[model samples]
Target: MKVFICERKMEVNYNIAEVYINKILFSHFWFHLLSLGLRMILSCLSSFRTLVNKSNPIASRNQSC
Candidate 1:
């Protein structure tokens, strides 16, 4: 009976470890996804800003005229 109880304890410990590892993996996945999303957003914003600057001719207009 004691051996059976010990085996059960080990199983429970294994399950707990599995859950902890899964949580770490899940968070890592989310962190990677968030970083990728942020990078995409920054790139898009920079491109849009470049487009706006190119279309805005006020900067090149002569003030002396």
Candidate 2:
């Protein structure tokens, strides 16, 4: 009976550790994905802004004012 109780305690501890590790891994994955998305958006926006300025020099000059 004592051995059975000890085994149960170990099983609970193992389960808790598994859940904690999974949570950490998932958060890291999501943070990486979000940063990549933000970088893509910023790059695209900058390129678009440059294109607009190239097509309209007067507008770009006005914006500098």
What's the number of clashes in each of the models? 0, 0
Best by lDDT: 2
RMSD of each: 2.7, 4.4
Task: Tell me how many residue pairs clash in candidate 1.
Answer: 0
lDDT of 2 by residue, 25-52 (tens): 9999999999999999999999999998
In candidate 2, what residue range of length 10 has the lowest lDDT sum?
Answer: 53-62
lDDT of 1 at 42: 100
Q: After superposing candidate 1 on the true structure, give the runs of residues whose Cα lies further than 4 Å from its correct spot.
A: 57-65
Candidate 1 residue-wise lDDT, 11-47, digit = tens:
9999999999999999999999999999999999999
Could you tell me how far off, in angstroms, the CA of residue 10 lies in candidate 2 after the best superposition?
2.3
lDDT of each: 0.93, 0.96
Off by over 4 Å in 2: 1-3, 58-65
lDDT of 2: 0.96
